[model samples]
Target: MTTPRTRMPAAARRTSILVAAAEVFGQRGYAAATTDAIAQLAGISQAYVIRSFGSKEALFIATAEHVLDLVTDAFRTAIAEADDTRRIEPLLGAAYVRLAADRGALVTLLHLFTLGQDPRIGPIARAGFLRILAILREEAGLSMERATAFLGNGMLVSTILGLQLPAESEDPATAELLEATFRENTPLVRELFGGRDLDG
Candidate 1:
């Protein structure tokens, strides 16, 4: 026997759809993902999914915005919690590492970034990216160089996750490179990626 699934409020249902959309879009990319897949993941009808977001492109834009909000909130919280101004970069980096465990939003945002040539999505992606950079510079009070370095390291982390490099434990060179690359954040990386192989 199984319990019946309770109905969600409209707002909650919308959010649920977005969460499912993020996971689907993250795995399949915007071009490949379909509302039917998202609806299946969300345990809803395709009609409801379409009604919630209008279209796949609109849903993707919403998903991108949602991901940006998550990232910006994480940075804001990290900045607020930092006791030492000098430690802000590491704090923010740690925040991102923690978030990367979820993988959906982060990977989806990465997919969004590759659409830089799209007249519609390109501006949204570029603006969202620049917004994060702005937060690091203005809100986090990091200098331009430091902010660039932080973002560069973040991009590297994204790549590592995207490539499933951390799961290549048998490759000593990969292990060594990751160890050196993450340095102080190596433990977090291990925790996030340890013993996990990429999905087929």
Candidate 2:
């Protein structure tokens, strides 16, 4: 007997659409991502995506903001759960390494950064970037230099992730960069790559 697929709840379905949109936009960039592909990936109708998000521009904005929310939320969780004795930086790094498994979100941030000249997206992107920086300073209680270094390290991780080099530990340079970039989070990176390790 063929099994029936259960319908996704409204919130879940919307989250799925946003996720699919992020992946499509990350892969194709904002200009080329289409509602049809996003719908297909989301297992929903294109009409639903449009009805929900209004337009491609609106969808892009929502997706970009959603990605920002995920990053900030992860950071908040790390801060909350961090041990008072140890530095929160490593916990935050581990949290980020865990989140970095979402290549779509990682790459979407990069694509978002390139739209600095865009009238609509430019402000959103800049604001989101600063928002993270601000959180590191005001909420996370990191000094100016530590916060800057944390964000810089995150960008480096993003760059390595966007390059897709961490998929395997085959290339010497790729392995070396992965080791260097992910240093303390090497085990998490290995887990993300499915048992692949720095040994090779």
Candidate 3:
């Protein structure tokens, strides 16, 4: 009988592949990203990538999952640091703006929301959004239905706005406009998230 070759740890392999796939998908979009490019970016053979992920769709799902995880982590951090419900929106909005500045992440996020809506990602996406909603509600002491509507709308609006903008618009005026927009919208988010009014 022939001896089998030693396999790399699954966690390490998957992490490396996902990282590479993220870069490729971020740059090229899901439709344009190739396994060959992902493998090359990962410093591994294409066969390895294929063997590990099985298909382009699977790899894209993994990349999307990674991005969602990052978003969840960011929100958790934002909520934790906030002094009150009113601070939640501004902190999260600030995080979103910072994420938008990341070219790779912004591109990847736009692609995911635009075209990567296959059934494969449906459950994962739902779970992630639900988790976020739960957190927002718990932190703000909102009822279930209200939390769902508020967080869901906030995410959709944020994604749409992020997608409509270019990845690297270098005009200072545009930068100022975006900053102003975020500031103006922060209060709206506070209201949606159940922040108490000062005048109440």
Best by TM-score: 1
Task: List residue ranges in candidate 2 displaced over 4 A.
Answer: 1-9, 194-200
Model 3 lDDT on a 0 to 1 scale: 0.66
Q: Candidate 3 — number of clashing residue pairs?
A: 0
Superposed Cα deviation of residue 188, candidate 2 (Å): 1.2
Residue 196 local lDDT, model 1:
91
Tens digit of per-residue lDDT, candidate 1, span 1-200: 99997867998888888899989997888889999999999999999888878999999999888888999999999999999998888788888988777777878989889989999889999999999999999999999999999899889988887888888956999989788777788888888786696433
Comparing 1 with 3 on lDDT, the higher-scoring candidate is 1
In model 3, the runs with Cα more than 4 Å from the true position are 1-10, 140-176, 184-200
lDDT tens digits by residue: candidate 2, 1-200: 98998878999998999999988887788888899999999988999999999999899989989999998999999888877725588888888877767767877788888888999999999999999988788878999999898889888987766666666577787788888877888778777753332113
Ranking the candidates on TM-score from highest down gives 1, 2, 3
- Global lDDT scores for all candidate models: 0.87, 0.83, 0.66
The estimated TM-scores of all candidates read 0.93, 0.87, 0.68
Residue-pair clashes per prediction, in order, are 0, 0, 0
Residue 14 lDDT (model 1): 82
